[model samples]
Target chain A: MSHLTREALARLVDEMPDERERTHLESCAGCRAELAALTDQRQALATLPDLEPGPDAWPALRAQLRREGLVRERRLPGVAAARAAAAMVLFLAGGAAGYLARGPADPPPSLETPSRVAGGAAPVDPAVAAAAQGATTDVEASASEAFMVALDRYMAATDAPPADPAARLAALENIVLTTAEALHEAPTDPIISSYHLSALAQRNAVLRQLSGDGGPPVF
Target chain B: MTDDELVRRAKTGEEAALHALYRRYAPRVHAVVRRLAGDDALAEDWAQEAWLRAFRALPRFRGEAAFSTWLHRVAVNSALQGLRSRARHEVRETVLPDDQAGPPESPATLRLTLERAVASLPEGMRQVLVLHDVEGFTHEEIGEMLGIAAGTSKSQLFKARAKMRESLGSREMATEGKAYVASDA
Candidate 1:
C-alpha cells in the first residue's frame, strides 16, 4: 500500500484516520513519525510567546489616542500636583517681585502662539500638526499652573483661609472663573496669564482629589 | 483593581483606567495582531487600531465575556479588516527564504525559522492557522470570525500545518528522530 500523503498526516494531527489509514499507520512507522512531527509543529506554533512591542509603542499609541480624543492628558499624582503648584507660585511670585522692583517697564513681549491652520485650507505635515498639538497642550498646562499660583496668592493676600477641601475647591473654582475673564481681556499679560494657569491647575487638582483620582488624599 | 471595575471606569472616560487596561493587555494584543498581519510594520498599525476600536466600543461591552476574550475578538477583527482593505488595494506575496542549509540545530534558530515560515504562509492559510492553532480559537469560532465555514477552516489549518512542516525543515528532524527511535529500540 502507498504511504500516507503529507496532507493526510497533517489531518491526522486533529482528526481520526479512516480504517485504511489506521491500518496503514498501524504498520507504517514513517507515516506515524511524520504525523507526530506535524503534531509537534502545531504545538510549537501554539506555544509561541507573546511579543512585546517596541519601547515607543505606548507613546505612539498614546499620541494616536490623544488625537482621537480617547484618552485625556495624564494627571499628576496628589503630592506632585501640589509640589508643582507651589513651585509655579514661587517662580511667578519671584517674577512678579522683580517686575514690581523694576517698576514695570513697557508691556512684556507677545508670546509666540502657533497659528491654527484651518483644515483643507493648506496641506499641513502630520509631524508639524502633532508638534503644534503638543505645544498647545503644554501652553495650556503652563497657563493653568500660573493661574493656580496667582489665585492662591490672591486668597492668601486677602486672608481668606480655606477651612476644608470643599471650601478650597469652591475658592479655586471661583478664582478660575474670574481669571478666565481676566485672561480674555489681557490674553498676553504675564500676571493675568499666570493667574489663569494657577486657578486651572489648582481647580484641577482639587477636582482630582475629590474624585479620588489615584492620588493621595491631599493634593 | 478588578477588570470589571477598570472596564466600568474606562467606560466613563477615565484615562488612568484606560491606561491600566492597555498596560495589562498590550503584549497579548500585539501578538495576535502581529501573527494575523504577518508583517511587523502592519502589525503595529493594526494593534494600535485594535485598541482604538476596543476603547471606542467600551461603552457597549456587557460583562458577558471576560475582558480579555472581548479584547481578543476586537484585535482579531481589526487585523482581519485591515488585511481585507489592503487586499483591495494591492496583491503582494512574501517570498520565503530557502532553508537549503538544512534544519537549524539550536532551539533559537529553529524558533526563528518557524516564525519566518508562518509569516510566509499564504494569507488565507496564515489567518486560519493563527486563529485556530496559535490563538486557540475553535474551528467554529474561527469560521465565524473569518466568515468561512468550519470545514474550510479545518482544511486551511491542515494545509497550513503541512506547509509549515515543509518550511520548518522538519522532515529531516523527523528522519533523525526515527533513526534514534530505531537505535533505542
Candidate 2:
C-alpha cells in the first residue's frame, strides 16, 4: 500500500489502471486517498467558465489575415501594388540620371574618320553598333553610337545624287533628323560638328539632284 | 446547413457560411479557451482566430472527421498556440484595481490569473489538460488526435492534471483537496 506510486495514483485517477494494479490500489489506503485528491483536482478544472470575445477585435484580425495571405497562396494585391510602384520609380530614375549626366550643350563632332585601307572601307564593328542601341541609359553613349551608324550608312551610299530633287531632299532630311537626335543626347559634345557637317553636305546633294543632274552618276 | 454544405459554400467565399460556423462553435471554443487561459478577452480573441483559421483551411477539408470536432481541435490548438507565443500579453506588469472581480484568492479576480499559470505549464502537460478536462475530448479521441499510445495518453493526462493543480492552486486554483504528487513507478 505504501509502495503504490504517483503514476499508479495518476493511472487510477484517469481510470486506466490494470486489474493487478487495481487490486494493489484496493489494498492500499494511501493510494486511495491520493486518488481522491487527483479526482478533486480534475473536477475543479472542469468548471472554468467560457471567455466571451470583445467587439473591437474582429475587423482588425480579418483584414490582417486576408491581406497577409498564407505563405502557400499568392500575396495580397496591396503588397503587389506597392512593389510595382517602387519598380516604376527606379526605371524613371535611371532615365533621369542619364539625362542629367549629358547636361546642357551638344559637344563638337569627332574628326576620327574611318582609316582608309587598300582593299575597301573598313568594316564597322558589329559589337560597337549593338553597344550604341543599348546605351539608352547613358544619353551621351547612345547619341555617339547613333552618329556612327548614320556616318557609316552615308559613306556606303552611292556618291551621285538622284535627278529627282525629292529623293535627294529626303536623304538630307534623314541626316538632319539623326543629327538633331544626337545633339539632344549630348548637347555640348564635339561630335555634334560631324553631324552638322553631314547635314550640310546632304543639303548640297539635294540641290544638285533637283537641277536636272540627270540621276546620280554611276558609282 | 450541414457541415459539408457549409464547408463547400465557405470554399466559394460565402460570408454567411463563415458567420454560421462561427455562431455554431464560437461558444464551445470560447468556453474551452476560457478554461485554458482564464482570461475572457484572450479567450474570445483566440476563439475568433480559430474560426479565421478554419475559414482559411476549409478548402483542404477532406471530411475525415466531424466538422465540429475539427473546429474544437483548431480552437484548442489556437489557444495553445497563443499560449506558446510568449509575447502575447505576458503576465501584466501593472496590477489592475480590485473591483468586483475580487482578489487572486477569489476565482472572480478582475484579472484572470489562470492564463499565466496555464501558460506556465510545460507544453505536453498543458496541452493534454486543455484537451481532456476542459475541451471534453475523450482519452481514446486524444490518443487518435495526437498519435500517441492510449496508455501514454492516460499517463500524460494524469501528469497534466497534477501540473494544473500546482499552477492554478498557487492561489486562484487552490481548492479543498489533499495535494497528491503525481509519481512515475
Candidate 3:
C-alpha cells in the first residue's frame, strides 16, 4: 500500500483524479483520513471571510504610497517630517558608525555650550565697574552671582547627600532673599529684574510644594 | 458604451470611454486585483494602475483578447508584480505595515468561506484557483496568464487546494488567513 504524502493527498482531494488516485483514496484508510481532512479543509476554506476591501481603504493607501514614494515626485506635503526623518536616519547612522568605528576604551568628555546671549555677563560696563568692580547692573551681577552660587550649591549637594525638607526650605529662603536684594539694587536693568522675579516665583512655588498645608511663611 | 465600443474608444485615447469601461468592470477588476495582490490597498492601486495602463496603451491593443480579458490580463500582470514585490519585501522586512498586515474583505460579498482560505494561497496558486474556480477560466486560460503549461496550472490549483486544506486544519487558528478582492459584477 502506497502512503500518500500530504501534498499528494491534498492534490487528490480537489481534483478529479485519475482512476488510480480515486481508487487509492477509497482503499487506503490513511489516505482516506488524509482525504477527509482535505475535504474538511476545502469546506473550511469555503467559509473564509469576505476580503473585499471597500472605498474607505483608499486614503491610507494614498498616504502610504506617498510616504513610500522613494521615487514618485512632487513631494506629497509633510516636507518637514520628511526632512526630519531623513535627518534622523542620517544622524543615527552616523552616530552608530562613529561609535562602532571608534574604540570604547576612551570616552570623550561630554560637551556643554553655555549660551552667552541668554544672560552670561558681557564685558563689564566701565561706569558700573567704577561704582562696583563687579557691577554691570546690580541685577545682572547678582543674577550672575546667583546663578553661579546655585550651581556651586547644587554641585556640593550632589557630593553631600541632599539636605532634608527643613534644610531645603532654609536654602530656598536664602535664594529668595538674595534675589530680592539684587532686584532692589538693579532696578534699572530688566534682565536682572526678570530673573529676580522668577527667582521669587520659584521660591514661592517651592514653599507651597514643601508645605502640604497652607500657612504663613517659614524662616 | 458596449465593451467592444468601449475598448475601441479606450484605444483611441477616449479617457471618458476608458473611465466608463473602468466604472463598468471596476468591481470585477478590483476583485481580481485584491485577490491577486493579497493587499487590498495595493490591489486597489494595481487596479487603478491597470486601468491607467490599459488607458495609456489603448492604441497598442489589437483585439488579441476580449476587452475584459485584456484588462484582466493587464490587471493580473499589474497585480502579480505587486504580489511579487510584497513577497520579496516580506522576506526582507521584519515588520509589516498594518494595512499590509493581512487581507481584509473587499467591497464585494463573499460566497463560500473556502474562498478566503483559497485567497490566502501564494499568488501563483491563488491566481490559478481564482481563474479556474471563481472566474471560470480553463486551465488553458490560466496557463496563458501565468505563462505556464495548462497541466501546470491544474496541478498548481490542486496544490493550492491542498495547502489551503492544511492551513485550515488547526482549530486554534481563527481568521488566520487573509484575502480581499473587489468585484464589479
Task: Tell me, by TM-score, which candidate is best.
Answer: 1
- How big is the positional error of residue B64 in model 1, measured in Å on the Cα after superposition? 1.5
lDDT measured at residue B92 in model 1 versus the true structure, 0 to 100: 56
Q: List, residue by residue over A11-106, the lDDT tens digit for candidate 3.
A: 665567688877876776666765665555554444433334466444443444345431122221232222222222222222222232232443
Q: lDDT (CA) for every model shown?
A: 0.67, 0.53, 0.52
- Model 2 chain B weakest lDDT span, ten residues long: B91-100
Instruction: Kindly report which residue stretches of model 3 are placed more than 4 angstroms away from their true locations once superposed.
Output: A1-6, A13-20, A27-219, B11-16, B91-115, B135-155, B170-185
Clashes of 1: 16
lDDT of 2 by residue, B1-185 (tens): 79789877667665566666666666677777755554556666777677778778988988899998888788777876776664455542223233535655555641245445455666566667767876678878777766677677778877765565455442423444334343333
Specify the poorest-scoring 10-residue window by lDDT in model 2 chain A. A82-91
Q: Per-residue error at A120 for model 3, in Å?
A: 87
Which candidate, 2 or 3, has the higher DockQ? 2
lDDT of 2: 0.53
Tell me candidate 1's TM-score on chain B.
0.82
